[model samples]
Target: MVDGATTGLFLDAAGMKALGAAIAIAITGYASAIAEKDIGTAAIGAMAENEGLFGKGLILTVIPETIVIFGLVVALLINSA
Candidate 1:
């Protein structure tokens, strides 16, 4: 989008690289959130019925976070360039 004389984003090489990284991070966030949702509800429900399994259930619920960590690593790779 152009606002009169100013363009929305006139990205140079570095800016374009950053933009790509930002997009990758966003996608990673989405995937991680979805993954969490996939396992979290069931884990919580199971834990609610049986509190003894809290440790295992909690770890299982948070397992989705690994995707985000992988995404962070990818973002770091991009940022390093």
Candidate 2:
């Protein structure tokens, strides 16, 4: 019974770590999506007003993607640990 309890506890800890990693990735991706949505809307408006602004708008739209990259790194670190 003691061994079973110990094994269960260990598995629980591992599960928690996996959950944490998943949450980190999910939250960051969600945040990035929200940010990108707003940015995309604004970019479209800007592009409609001034065709010359397309390059700048594209860069701005892509900036939010870094959030997901950082999240991925954090997830990797959590899993590794």
Top model number, TM-score: 1
TM-score of each: 0.81, 0.80
Clashing pairs in 1: none
Per-residue lDDT of candidate 1, residues 1-81 (tens digit) = 434443336765567678878887899899989988878888888888999988988899888888888888888898897
- What's model 1's overall lDDT? 0.81
Clash total of candidate 1: 0
**Best-matching candidate per lDDT:** 2
Global lDDT of each model?
0.81, 0.90
Per candidate, the number of residue pairs that clash is 0, 0
What lDDT is obtained when candidate 2 is compared to the true structure? 0.90
lDDT of 2 by residue, 1-81 (tens): 344543544566577778889999999999999999999999999999999999999999999999999999999999998
Span of ten consecutive residues with least summed lDDT in model 2: 1-10
**Models, CA RMSD each:** 5.3, 2.8
In angstroms, the error of model 1 at 68 is: 1.0
